[model samples]
Structure formats: structure tokens, C-alpha cells
Target: MTSAPAARASMDAGRALPPPVLVVSIVSSYLLALHPGTLPRDATTTAVVTSGFAAVGAVVGMLLSRWASRRRPHPDTQTRRVVFGAGVLIAAGGAGLSVWWQSLIRAAVGAPPVGPDWWVAATVAPAAAVAAIVLIPRVTAVIAASAVALAAGLLAPADAGADRGQPSPRTIVVSEFGTLLRGELAAPEFDHPAERLVRSWMHSGGLAARAVIVAVPTGSGWVDQAAVAGFVDRFDGDVRILTLPYADVPSWKAFISDDATATESSITLVRELAKVLANRPAGDRPRLVLYGQSLGAVGADAARVWLEDHHPSLLAETVLTAPPAGTVAQASRTPRIVVANRSDPVVRWSLGSLWRPPAYPDDTVLGGRRVPEVPWLPVVGFLQSSVDLLAALDGPTGVGHRYGTEQARPVSGLPR
Candidate 1:
């Protein structure tokens, strides 16, 4: 029979092997799932691929566990060390292969590559290292080193298809503000005042002849900067763009409290915008066009409501991209467009309910119990890509819920 120390050593060697195998299996499973070719072309295909990955992971994990338990004891420490070192190498190789494969897959799919998140790798590495130490006999040092190397590689920042080239025109001016002002002015495109006035008043009220674009900065404010530049480049008009800072809700709470003032700053900015437009000459009769994303979307919606209630004749169009929860319905009636992405994890959370129940009239809600189909997916994708390009220019985390290189398309006829 094998002695206690011999058996213990054997068990450790076996343990080391299983961890590498587990890492390989996990990385393989994720890559398989992410392969563009396997992505569900239809609802049925998606369900199949998702289920397949889950099942494979479960089966592989079980098998690895059983295999690791069956190894026999060996008295040679060098042999055990060799086996442990091999396992570490295998695990690191598997991780490296996974990353390389994913990059290739992304390129093949014509989609942007998945950039590395150091934070995620940092959290994953230590667990992997511990597993290596416990499983491999006499090879704990090698396993730890391999784990660190793998983690470092995985966590290293990568190019996310962001360097397509510099923007042709680097700045934009968003001019329409309040309810009656209508028009957009960009670096490359200039809006005709008469045409803008007609378009601004075409919908709800005939009183306002022009609209102003209000830029409300949220979070880091990079989005506001990029959006203004993009608008100026693409839009052909003389619309005015006003830059406004995010408002603090606590300060505004003393004035208005019945409603949750989560986006009080945005509301305050819109209210101030109306006052500014009112002071303009008669020809500049103010109409409003609001553009907001993520948290700013929520603020823009509140501002839209405030505009409609106070200056009914001045309301125009509202475009919200990837807005947070509780902001969709605010743009329901007016010429409103919402852009959302299916792959975006954050947007996925809010996809369940675009509008809250009770207040959502039966006619306005689409698809009944299931979430309504977002009519602006294409636009969202374009805007997302544009934001990505902008991020590359600015050298920051532009992929996360911000304005990027994605172009915003017109969604005029789609059902909300």
C-alpha cells in the first residue's frame, strides 16, 4: 500500500492537472459561445447555442473532477514536479489560445474585437493561482508564475478597432433648445433657418419657428463633447448648440419635490433654456430638440416634460440613446426616437421594460408581455461605433455607456 506522504503527493499532482484542464475547458467554452458563426441567426439558433455552452461546461467540469481523483501515488518528487509544471503550462497556453482565437473570431465577424478588462483578469487570476498551488505537487512555484503571466496577458489592454483614423472635422455645435427652436448646425453641415422652422413646427404646435439643441453633460462629459462635434459635422444648418452641466438634484429639491428629482439638473437646464429662448428676437421663437444618453437620457426626458408643460407650443423632437430606466416614455408622443443595442449588457437590464406599467396605455406598448422591439437598433449600432471612434481619439473608456464612433441614423417611420 502507498504511504500517507506518497498518497498525499500523488493527490496534489493530480489536483494540479485538473485545474489546467478546467481552465482550458472554461476558455474553450467561452470562445465557442462567442464565435461569430455560432451566434444565433434566429431565435431558435440562439437558444440552441446558449443551451449547448451551458451543457458543455457542466459536463466538462464533472469529468475533470472525476479524472483528478483517480491518479495513483508516486514516491519521486521530481516526477510530481514535472507533472505540475506541465499542468500550469497547459493552463496558461489554454488561456492564451482563447484570447487569440477570440480576436480572430471578432475579425472574421466584422465586429469590433473584445478589449481586455484588467480588473476582470485581476479578479480571476488569484483564484486560478490558488487552484494551481493546491493541485500540483512540488510545482506550486511554476503554477503561480504561469497564473500570473496568463493573468497579465489577459488583462493587457488591446486595440478595440478604434484607430480607423482621425475625425475629419473635430468639433460640432448643437443649437436647438426649448420647445419652439428647431435646427441643427455641424462643422460640415449647415441648416437653413426657414427650412428648420418649418420642420420644427410641422408636428405638435404651429407657433414656434425654430428649435435649439441643448448639450447636457453627464458622468464624465466626454459624450457631450463628441456629440456636439459629430452633430456639427453631419448636420447642415445654422442651429445653435448650448453646453450645459449636469445639475445637482439636492439644490433643486427645495423648489420641486413631489416627483423623484433624480435628474433635477437636466430639468433645471431645460427650464433655463426656455428662459434663454424667450429672451431671443421674434424670429428666434424657441422650439426644443433634446438629445441624451444613459443617465443623461433620464435627465433629458424630465426636461422634455418640463418644456411641454410650461411652453406647450415650443416642443419639437427628442432623441434618447441607451437611456437608463424610467426615461423612455417621456419621448413617446413627440417625434421621439430611442436607440438601443441588443449586445450591450447594461442596456439589456433596461430592455425588459421600456415604459413602466399603468401609465403605459395599451396602444403605446408593443408586443404585450414581452419587451417591445427597439425600433432603432441600427442607429444604436452606428452611434455606438461612432462613440468608440471618439473614445479612441480621446484615450478613455468610451465603450461603456457613452457616445462613440457609431453614427446616428434617422428612424422616422419605425414603430416605437
Candidate 2:
């Protein structure tokens, strides 16, 4: 079913890349793209500037393709060369259309204009074009597939609207793993999963822990067991965790417009916990802690008002990780800890929340990693944030948008 030339070309293109080359290029490309600040206020003007950058990239890609073909005279190389040229052509057209498209959205919807700094994205146009010409042809397929997926995600119908949302639930989903962590003094005294909770007793032979935690699942509807392993093992005494089940989907897309789903589930969890907290005597009452990660973090944070209004109780603390944009109005008043990696893009897209410099509050903690320092370009940085987001999801924590570093370790508020 394959042609000789096509088969040969596939083999040449699919050769395994060295880890170092792969790591360096990805980091370089992402950092070069992320110089966000002070974008042009006019969306049209920003697009025009971005278009200018694409023109520059076309010329650069052509030159690189010609140079690479001469140095490596092979049919496969020639094919890549052609593909790179085509990519440039497509990119130029797309840039022009993207500007026009944004304009239409503004004209029709009365939405805010795209930021002026977004135009700076054009600066990386040339570099990205050249990389395609000289480096990985494999990435081409990924980009193409992503284009299709984006369309599908955007086209999906909207969920529960602002005025009314889905009804509340009577039962919640609870999961149990024998130990969230292994090693060093984690003994279960009153181990129970049937009540939809997990309780771990201290290794020092304590009867029970004096505190409890109720954590919501991530946007994807499951907990990152490893990330929470430390929380389970850190307590000096018994710690109880109650988790809700909204396992219908594994992505934030599942909850985008569905505020009610998050509100209802979180409300149910809090209400049920309040009943247990109400019954206990003061000395025996476990200190309540609220926790959420990623999408779960946003939902848990936002639902604070409703929880307080209806189930009002003093929570000892709320801990969140990789929380997406918490609008200025959604900012929390309670003492809570937010952990975010400087490289994560989900936080960046929120405009002012996690990673970008001008947006964080004085109390926020940022973990630094090396990023190629390029000139600060707002528009370009905005454009680059999308790429960095992908890389962060697939690449490194502190370096790309991913999280999982020692710096992010659970500290004193949790058990030792």
C-alpha cells in the first residue's frame, strides 16, 4: 500500500531524535515566544504587526530550506523543504485571517479588542518557520491534528447557562487507595471507604488524627494520587479526605460553561461534611481543610461564596495548585495557598493570575526555570503562550507549563 519513495521518505523523517536536542529546541522555542506585556490596544493593528512578522518568517524559511537542501542532498530533505515552504504560505494566510476573524467577533459580539502586545507574536514567525524547514517533520502532523481538535472543541454546544444550572445530586463518588503514600509511619486505625472517605492514622500509634480534608477532583475528574500522596502521609495523627465524583469527563472542557455542575457537586460535599462536623464535640472535631487542583481548584475557589452563604463554617485552610484564571471578582478573602509553575500557560491565558509578571499579587510564589530571554513583545508573547501551554502539558514543570518539582512540596500546614 506504500510507494517506494514515500516509504523511504517516512523512514528518513521518523528517525529517533536525541533527548538533548529535543529538550533544548523545545525549551528555546517556548521561551523565545513568551515575552508578554503591554500589547497594542487595537486588535487590527496587532494583527497587522503579526502579519509583518510572518512575512519575515517566509523569507527566513525559504533561505533555510535552500541551505539545508544543498547540505543534505536527499529526496527526503527536498520533501521537507517543500513542506516547510508550504507551511509558511499557510501560516501567512492564517495570520491574515485570524486578525480578520477576531475583528468579526468584536464587531458582532461587542467583546473587548485583542491586546496590542499580541502583535509581537510575529517576531517568532520566522524562527518557527525555519525550525519546521530544518528540524522535525513529525511535528507537522501534530499541528494539523490539533487544528482539527480545536475546531471540534469550539463547536461543541455550550453547557448550563448563567441564569440556570443543572440540579444538585443526592450521592457523590468516593475512591479509596490503601495508602496515598508508602513508607515512614503511615498506619490506618479507622480505615473506612464504604462511607466514601479515606482515613489514615499516624505511624506513632495514635488513635485518630484531629483534622480532615475534603478535596475536589481535577478538571479531568480524578485526583493526581502522587501529588496528594504527601498530604495523606504528612499528618501527625489521623487525616480524613472526602472526594466527590464527577468522572463524566477528564478535561476542563467538561465544565467550561457548566458552572452549576461544579457548584452543585462542591455544595453537596461541603453540606455533608458540615453534618459530620456539627455532631462532633469541640475537642474531638477535626479541623476542616479544602483542596482542589487545576480545574477543581477554580471550582472549589469560586464556590466559596455559596458554601459560606449556605453551609457557613470556618475552614482551617484551602490549598490549590495549577488554578486557572480566577477573575478579579473571584479572588479569595480567606487565607489560602496557591502553587503555580512559572512556565504553565493555563494560568497565563487568564491574563492576571499565576505566571505572568505584572499579574500576580505580592503573596504569590513563583518557581523559576531557565527561559531564553528574548525582547519583551506583548502580542508575540500572547501567541507564544499557546505553544508554551502545549509544551508545559507535555514537557517540564518549572520550565514548561507542567508542575511536579520539589519546590511544590506540601509544607508545614500538612503533616510532617
Candidate 3:
């Protein structure tokens, strides 16, 4: 029979190993990073791939844990308890440090500091880390390898389809109907994006458009072209979409400064348009509407504007999809629609940010349930929210932030 020390040492060695799920996650992530062929190399691809890694890691973890349980049952020991305690502390410390780091970064940039979302990340990440440390025996080598592989994935060059050769935003406008509808590019003539949108609106000044939509784009300058197409089709092509553009940051990873710039530009565009449309006959006036998603939605929330006399000509119906639950905006005089999916972290990470059972003139669709004030429960959802954000990209639940063709269909009884 093995001696007590020998058996203990063997069990300890097994406990120290990195979880097989984590090992697979890192490897799969690296492989995906290497093989996203022909897809526009952008943040969406990264989000989708990263989430896939997390999902696989989760599944493998559950299966392995169950199998290990059936092999032998080890009695709880003082040493094991100590190890688990240390891990929990370490995880908590790491999460706290990350939150502090994020705060410093935001302050340095002069942006609104992070809200409850950071707290959620702080709680969730540490718990996850501790779970790995506790469940996987002899995890050092696997952890190091996984880290290295992930680093490789992040550092890899991801530009695909030679996107530099693509057309400018100004050239991508939809002149009439029965043409390309994916509105992705910004108007070219000027360096400032909002100016381009204003000019585009002027170019269509002659049309008797029944409605106009001023859209604020996400960090990547994507205003959901397919969504735009759906919006325009719903309006019977009598509408002109003025997409207010700012810097085309790679993804939602763009700075809060970029968000501020976009918000300011959106405000400028809407104000100018409102000025021009102020004098049109009541029957001939085009209904002004605003659409934004993710970062764009946040910017729209910030651009909350009204005329000197509280006129509603410039701003009418507004649609905000997956807005950050942090910042608060005043209620709009007109119909305000907030669309969100419980699966998206960006929309649910901040406690009290997403208006549960949306009130008043503001109507909200199913984004997520309200965050429980309980200690780490909110944080738990926040972690899942992070992964769900990537899941949102593919509309895995068919009701995520992307909203696809069903985008316009959600706002029932509203004008197109």
C-alpha cells in the first residue's frame, strides 16, 4: 500500500494541473485566430471566436469534472481547504486590481468612470480564476501554455479581404431605391464624419422625403447596414438615412473619447437638420428619427437635445439598442424605444443602468432581467454578459443586439 505522504503527494500533483478545458480553449482560440478566412477582419470576428473558446472551455470543464468525481472520492483535508482559501483571496485581489486599473485609465482619458459593470467583472473574473485553480490539479503548465497561446492569438495580424481598397462612406450612399442597402462607409469629401452626413442630407434636400433617420454608428462606424436597409424598406424608400460618422475605431474597444466625439457630432447634425426642417409645412415635414446601437446607442443617449421652444421637429421617435447601462439620459418628449437582450453583457452589466420594465415614454423590450442587489449575483451575470456580447454578434438567440432583419419589426405600431 502507498504511504500517506506518497498518496497525498500524488493527489496534490493531480490537483495542481491546469484544467483540460482551459487548455483546449486556448488552443482553439489560437486556431480560430489563424483561420478566419475571407471574413472582414474586425472586432465581431474576435468577439465571436473568443466566446467560442469560452463556451468550449465551459463544456469540457463540466464533463471532466464529472468523470473525475466517479473515479475516487477524496476526503476533505486541512491542506486542501487552505489551498482553496488562498485561491479565493488571490482571485478577489486580481479582480479588485483590474477595477482600479480601469478606473485610472478612464480618469486619465477624462471619460465617465466605469460603473457597476467593473464591479461585476471584478467579482466574476476572480471566481472563475479560483474555480480553475481549485478544480484542476497540476494546472501550472497548462495555464502557462494557455496564456501563451492566447497572447499569440491577440498579437496576430487580423486584416482580411484587403479592406483598405474598399470605397469611402460618401460613395456608399443609397440614392433612390432598388440599390445596395448596406450603408457602411462614411461620406468622403471631408475629414469630419458629421459634416459628410450633413452634406449627404443637403444632397437629398430636393427629395420630398416623408421621414429622415439620423443614425449614430458604433466604434467601427457600422450602423447595422442591414438594419438600415430594413428601416428604409419599411418606410417604402421615401426616407433618407443620415449616418453620422466619427472615427472608425476597430471595435467596441475604442476609447470613451471616441464616444464623446461621436455624441457631439450627432448633436451637431441633429441640431443643424432641425434648423433646416423647422420651416417646412406641417403636412410636408419629414418625421425625424434616431437609431444607434452599442457605442452608437450610448452616444445617442448623450446627445439628448431639444429646441429652444421644446419643438419636436428635429427629434421624433428614437431607437436605442443595447445601450450601456451606466449613463443616464433624460426622457425624450417623443416615443423612445430601448431594445436589449438579456444575453448581452454590454446592455446588462451595469446594475440599475438597464431600466427594468422600462417606464413612461420609454418602452423597453427584453434585454435582461434586473440585477439582484445581492453581493456577487450581479457580477455572475456580468461575466456571462461578457461572453453573451460575442454571442449577440451571431444572433444566437435571434433577439440579440445585432437584431438583423427583425430590427425594424420590433417597434410595432411605430412609424417606419
Candidate 4:
């Protein structure tokens, strides 16, 4: 008789477990349907939707726990086990569905599908479920159920959205030193075939005129698609922008030593550019300008020196924007301009050595009487607006080291 009661109790417990699992799975599925786009592009939309799900889960969990608590309990070990197994299956199913949805979205957008990583969603769900089961008994299963419901609401959908497809941003690869070498040799070409602005710009200018504008990317890795197109469209003269491949070159003896193989590779690039610039006819000899941001500034500075020493007349100007940690000295006999912004955090860290008051006094004359403190966002936005390089030249003024705005002017009386 006891065995019969135990069997009946187990069956009852088993029946109880499915409701929670079904609730969680349904919630997860619903969230997976709403794909929030990637960061910066759809940040606001993602945040709003995520918050909404969290709120709804909290209310539903509370109500479900209250209803479950009032029901008569049965001691059914077999039923409990069955329910637990079912919950696990539901969790696994939800995760699988999320992965499939993400893959489909990526395929639709021409992005590489993300493969199943052990680290993604599989680990979190089980742990959360176990926590809910353990806590519910001690604190009135109603409260525990509510907590689990809320957690499920927040995490299940958030995970689904996190799995949303991301289209790979276009990338251009070139060596650190290879960029200068390319500039020295042939005029740069747009790497991406889809860039309409670059094609249009090239069509407008004849071959000779198009050769003057040199495109210098700032950091390592793939270049930004919008930035590349924007530069091409906004350039007043003939422009050639080269996208360098991503390579890590730390500022250490291993990388920068004169005898280092990497150093040699860098120098070879400069030599190539010098040879190219040297061969051009006087009428066709374009004024070389080095434009670089961040670490690219260092490469540009080095290339400028190499060109001036070997082919002095080729260099017209050097523009260093948000250069890495280094003193900006004369890269060549030609004129050099440094554009810094006040609001850039990275630039501030870089400017620590460069912005000494005693050695590198602020040039008040060039900055005008009132210093400008343009925010980083506006400056970056302005750059993105396809403004002419000449218009982009004037930024904000302050002691801060920013990229887009005119922060601090170079010390006056320095020879151009």
C-alpha cells in the first residue's frame, strides 16, 4: 500500500515540473524572435526591449509561486526526477533554438555563422535552474518560483538577443611599414570593390591628380568601412588610401631594434615608397603628406623621415592625429601639423609625456584667445559627415589630447 502511494505521489510531482519548464521555454522562444541589432547601431532598441522582458518576468514569477504554494504537496520521488529531466530538456531545447535563429539571421545578412562555443548559453541555464529548485523549498516555493521566473525572464531572452547575427565589418590588411612603402610606390586604391564614393572620386580626377591624396589608416587590424569611404569622398585633391593588414608591433627592442627583422621589413616599405616617388616626372611629382591616427601616426612619422632624408622634395606636410605615446618632433624638413582633441580618453593617456608645460608649452597664438573644448562625440561625428579635410582641420582647444578636435596647438616658433 505504501509503495502504491509513493508511486502516485511521484507521478504528481512529475506533473508539477512541466509548467515552469514550459514557461521558461516559451519566454526564451519569444525573445529569440526579436533580434536586437549590434551595438552602436541598435544600442537603444536592444536596451529598451531587454528591460521590458525583465519586468514582465518578475511579475509572472511572483504569481506562479503563489499559485504553486497553495496546492497540496505529494512525496513523489519518481515524479520529481521526471519533472527535473523535462526542465533540463526544455532548457537545452531553448538554447539550441537560439543558436539556430542566430545562424539564420547571420546568413541572411551575409555574415559568417557563429559556431557553437561551449562558453555561450549551455552553462548558465542549468545553474540557474538548480538555484531555483534549491531556494524554493526553504523560502516558500512561491518566492523561489517568483525569483526563478524573474531570472528566466531576464536571462533567457537576453541570451537570445545576444545571439543576434552580426555582419562582419569590412577589413583591409597592410603592414605597419608597408603603408608608407605603398605610398612611395604607386597611388593607393580602395580595397573594397563596393565603395561607391571611392570609384566616383577616382573617375572625377585624372590619373595624375588622383595620385596626390594618400590614405593612412590609424590603427592595426581591419579598417572601418565608413571611415574609408568618408575619407575618399571628402578629400579635395587626388587621394590614394591604403588599408594595411593588422599586425602587432609593440614598442620594444624585439620589434623596433635597428637589427630586428621587423624593423628591416618596415624600412623596406619606406624604400619602396621612396623609389616610386623618385621616378615620377617633375610635373607629375605629387606632394607627399603623411596622415595617421594612433599607432599609424608612428609609422607615418617614421616614413616621413625616411622620405625627407632620401627624397626631400617629395614631402609637403605631415599630419599626426591622436598619436600614441611619443614626442612629436620634426619628422622632416617639411611642415608638420598635430591635431589633438580634449575629450579623448586614449589621447589623454598618450599626451601625458607630450603635454609637459615647461618643455612643451601650449601655443596660445595658434589656438586663439579662447580655448575650445569640443566633446569627442561631436568631433567624431563631424569627421563622419564627409566634411572636407580642410574643414575638419579646425577642432577644439584645451590641454586634453583628443583626436578630432583642436585641443592644444603645437608650441609656436618651431620651424615648419
Candidate number with greatest TM-score = 3
lDDT of 1: 0.42
Model 3 steric clash total: 18
For each of the candidates, give the backbone clash count. Answer: 56, 18, 18, 18
Ranking by TM-score: 3, 2, 1, 4
Give a tens-digit lDDT track for model 1, residues 292-363.
665556666677777777865555666666554344564355566665433232333333333322122111
Q: What lDDT does the true structure give each of the candidates?
A: 0.42, 0.47, 0.52, 0.39
Write one digit per residue (lDDT tens) for candidate 4, span 276-359. Answer: 567777667544555555455556566667667777777666656555334345333666665543322323333232333112
How large an RMSD does model 2 have? 17.5
TM-score for predicted model 1 compared with the true structure: 0.43
TM per prediction: 0.43, 0.51, 0.56, 0.36
lDDT of 3 by residue, 1-416 (tens): 99999989988875665444334443333233222111111234333443344434444555665676678564245444555455445445544554454455334323356566445443444335434544573473386469779988887332111113323363446545522222334423223444445555656552367677777776555666565777777777677777655555443444344457666656766776666687777677777777777777766655555432345555667778767665436465566777765434455555442233222224666543221121233334344344444434433223334355455543557645
Tally clashing residue pairs in candidate 2.
18
Q: How far off is residue 106 in model 1, in Å?
A: 2.1
lDDT of 2 by residue, 76-195 (tens): 444445554554465455545544554543443243655544444543544454455346545754764686699787864322111112222234322364222111111121112212
**Which scores better on lDDT, 2 or 3?**
3
User: Which has the higher lDDT value, candidate number 3 or candidate number 4?
Assistant: 3
